[model samples]
Target: MSQKHLTIIDHPLVQHKLTIMRQKDVSTAGFRRLLREISLLLAYEVTRELELTTTRIETPICEMDAPMLEGKKLALISILRAGNGLLDGILEMIPSARVGFVGLYRDPETLQPVQYYNKVPKELDARMTIVVDPMLATGNSLVAAIDLLKQAGAKNLRFLCLLAAPEGVERMRQAHPDVPIFTAALDERLDDHGYIVPGLGDAGDRMFGTK
Candidate 1:
């Protein structure tokens, strides 16, 4: 199905947090903390299509009907380690949302992503899946994740990330343009090393303090 691809780079608070996250000298603890904070901010854009239902309820003073979210739980799929950073923060607000993980790593030979692990909920067909990753550098991993989700019967899909490069966004646009993408900032370009230009460096490494 064709879907509108939306990018969230307009919010000031989002921009500020993203800027801090993108600095080269930021500490690992600080980098991870910022990712968590930015993910919450990005979650606002990702949940725009959530279904809402109306019900009768009573307030402390007034008795009135209110609108609340309906059933068919949401599935927030994280793309392994770095993506896990966002999961905790989003779960803080919507703790009941079902979680899924898709583990994909770049193959040493092809530099292509290889899926090594995937354990999604059994009722994926009835859920709205949002895939989370910190950066969209090559777009291969995100594209691969979306492809796998489609094969699993996930029709409604959205992508949430901290930052996206112009090249990666365009590549994703061509491959899966129907999927909406949410991120705090869109950098000018990707460097020759397959990293976002002026990107904070390997998100996983920086976030984990490994390098």
Candidate 2:
């Protein structure tokens, strides 16, 4: 199901890739590769609304108008660490897109986000910005990341992730209703430890081979 604030990408290829990544036995290399492939698919759905303008072009046989993305190149803000997994694949598709990073770690005890680093592109107000992160479990970190981006003059923004929890989706909706979320799946709920149940474990760990 989809709402104004959230979009679930249920493409068969995406689902198949996600299922493999969920298995505890999947190696770090395998998980990282799958995440990159899935990010390419998710990027399609998330950027569907990009404005386009026709540009005059010459074909071998004739001249014609070709559709091109309008305005300044879009900006992609990776939410650090795990977000880099998704960022890598999307960059392959939009090579000219601007890139930035925001680093925020969740405090295990309080389940809140703590910012540690941030750097974003200039002219955020004039470009469409998309925030990339692998998991949106508690939504605390994602929300905090977006908060910083807005403070930096970003007005148009979107959030993309591999998986999301209902609690996290609602948290984002309540906190930043203007931003839309795109994810491969919306899982059941978050566990007591603030982890998404049936989630693919810690995304950063699975992708980076770290504990």
Candidate 3:
């Protein structure tokens, strides 16, 4: 996957909220609120290509064909903890979307993903699945999560995040070239510790007020 596979959502509102959220002094509650708000905007960008079909319906005055989402309900898979922040807003936008969770934590020494839990909706092969997480840093955990989802029969997939680093995007491109990535901003690069430089800090910590 090249830069063509990456979508940088340059929406003004999303950028504004993201800028505020990136500040060091932002409160946890404020950060959480901003994440939810920005996620709503990102949801619009991520689902823009959803298949649509017209259906016959009787209107107030006459019969007409109205456009509606086509095929199976969308699947929203959260890569646990931090991903939940993005999940909340997207769910609000698409309430009928099926939900799933894949829990993974990074090993401090290796900076690799360690899976602990996995629960995903069935019939993933039939639904358009969107994986949500706030950061695409090292991309190890995300790659592992998507690997599990694909093994379980998910065919269509997309990744949504607040921020992305070049390293993570490249990693995802190499591992899952078919999947498109949507993010609010593409930052400079990832630091030695696998953190996105100029990032707001650990999203899980910022959202939950943890160390």
Candidate 4:
């Protein structure tokens, strides 16, 4: 993966919150809270380059022109289950952004992603799409999700994740070089079972207390 296509958010606050989330003993409530807080920070970074325009507005004392977001509302596409965790927090910051979901599950034996559900807003070609998933271990799910989004007319797209593995990054780079990735931490690698090494285990299970 090219370094230019990936951004490692090494902010102290982000790292600190990620550390708490990675702990084995962290409670469901604590994990969910930290994920929300960290996602707000991530959302700020990902939306840094949003185009701005001036709009005339009246202040308490006088009328003035103020900067505001320009163009169509942004789209946030969550890669189902785990992605919902990140989606909620980012939505808190960008309540006006359009929301979408792609539901997929890994085939236990093949370790490949299988799409079961998908729903996105119309006119995707004009909006900046941000795809969110907690962990990018195998990259199959993300790559598949991107394929569907592109087929649906999404042109400008970005990927956001809490943690990523080297293999997953490489896979995504090969498949979708145009899409840049924003992540909190890039871990060592994927383990034998395709889980990210030193990662917060099973983000969905941890956040929802399923396991």
Best by TM-score: 2
| Candidate 1 local lDDT, 1-211, one digit each (tens) | 1235757556888888887877888888898888888778778878977999999988999989798988788999999878898888899878888999999986756658998998777677888888988889888888999998888889888888887887878889999978888877777897666878877788889888888
Worst 10 residues of 1 by lDDT: 1-10
* Residue 4's lDDT in candidate 1: 58
Q: CA lDDT, every prediction?
A: 0.83, 0.94, 0.95, 0.94
Q: Could you tell me the C-alpha RMSD of candidate 3 in Å?
A: 1.4
Against the true structure, what is every candidate's RMSD?
2.5, 0.7, 1.4, 1.5
Q: Name the lDDT value of residue 130 in candidate 1.
A: 88
> Candidate 3 has which clashing residue pairs, if any?
none
What's the lDDT for candidate 1? 0.83
TM-score of model number 4: 0.97
**TM values, all candidates:** 0.93, 0.98, 0.98, 0.97
Q: For each candidate, how many residue pairs have backbone atoms clashing (under 3 Å)?
A: 0, 0, 0, 0
Could you give me the TM-score of model 3 versus the true structure? 0.98
As for model 4, its CA RMSD to the true structure in angstroms is 1.5
| Candidates ranked by TM-score | 2, 3, 4, 1
Better of 1 and 2 by lDDT: 2
lDDT of 2 by residue, 130-165 (tens): 999999999999989988999999999999999999
